[model samples]
Target: MTLGMVALVGVGVALSARRSGREASSATRLGLAVVSVLALWLGATALLASTDVLSFRSARPSPWPLLPLSGIAALLLLGRAPLAKTLLANTPRHWPIVAQSFRIGVELIIFAWHQDGRAPNQITFEGRNFDILVGLTAPLVAWLVATNRVTPKPVLLWNVLGLAILANTVATVATSTPGPLHLDWPGAPFTAITTWPVLWLPALLVPLAVFLHVMSLRQTLTVPR
Candidate 1:
């Protein structure tokens, strides 16, 4: 895993600790803390593994399904309101929706920069530069939930866009081939310029994060109000 993953765990912990004080809902409070702990353990540790610092070569940024998976689980722990309850409930099927929102809100900006009528080296949109922005936005999303933002309606909007992005990613994943070259893109076979853990990002971290997000969302929506 990478230090970054570990860092996220710490961040999750801090967020949970803060929530515990402000959150009146037991479920939300517990979810926040638990997800924080998991993030510290699995997600952060895997990151160390991914970068070789920890030694799990196979582990990457996402580390088995922790990112969104944990995010969603954390969301559940955030407690229940009205919209939060609704959004959280269908998160299983709607998992992809959260992904789409993240892509559109956080990723579409980067896509515009790179998708300028040419294929860039990066495979997944989140894998490209400025993706650090996604890291920023997502935390804010979580923060909003923790703090009660301008209502989940906006989150729902972003969730729709996220779902769209998820579809695109799935399509891209299907089109991708692991060889000297690929079946989808007929030109270059493989290039380091584009291989900065590009495809691996979505395949590993994204699905995991998506699952977490969905789980969190479901929990947030379902907790008895």
Candidate 2:
């Protein structure tokens, strides 16, 4: 799932670079540079997780919160960069909508983790997390946009709802997990997320999903509807 998230980011970066009006070679280099940086970042995150740097006893404040916070900060900064602006201006508006389908896999993994007893039911589809709905509707929304059956207004609304739901899911897990913000809940704690591999769910996957939705909103809002 970690590698898949990285690959998805690379795809978005490559597509954006290609459509940024740069020459093919320059675009390819730009894409590679952005993707390489993200790959390296993920590698470091994974290493930290392996060393138990991201995890701690359930009674203590987990270092895991820092990972998602840092990732979100980086993404926000990146979104303000010239490259991101160019990408928003050039990339097809529907691309981000389509890209959101990746969340299906994310929810699936969470569901499986819950079943495996690694995660809590409160963070799964059967629980408070309804993020799977956004993923399931992504294809339909993209198709509506493609067929001109919906305007940018509707797309923007969809993005807003998606972002809100994602934020809810993040909140659900953060509170349910063993951390500074931990909230008491029934069943097992969501300690699996602080471990290696699974840590990427918050560090990479959630942040990437956020970026996609925010970028899609930017693109849709600026369209000459």
Question: lDDT (0-100) at residue 115 of candidate 2?
Answer: 84
User: Which residues of candidate 1, in runs, are more than 4 Å off?
Assistant: 14-149, 179-183, 189-200, 219-225
- Model 2: residues >4 Å from true position, as ranges? 58-60
Best TM-score among the predictions, by candidate number: 2
lDDT of 2 at 20: 77
Query: Ten-residue segment with the worst summed lDDT in candidate 1?
Result: 187-196
Task: List clashing residue pairs in candidate 2.
Answer: none
- Tell me how many clashing residue pairs each candidate has: 35, 0
Write model 2 residue lDDT over 14-131, tens digit each, in one string: 7777777778777777777877888888888888877756566545577787888888889989899886888778887778888899888889988988888888898989999999
The superposed Cα distance between candidate 2 and the true structure at residue 89, in angstroms, equals: 1.1
For 170-215, candidate 1 gives per-residue lDDT tens digits of 4443334233223555533222212323423432445444554455
Task: For candidate 2, give the lDDT of residue 116.
Answer: 88
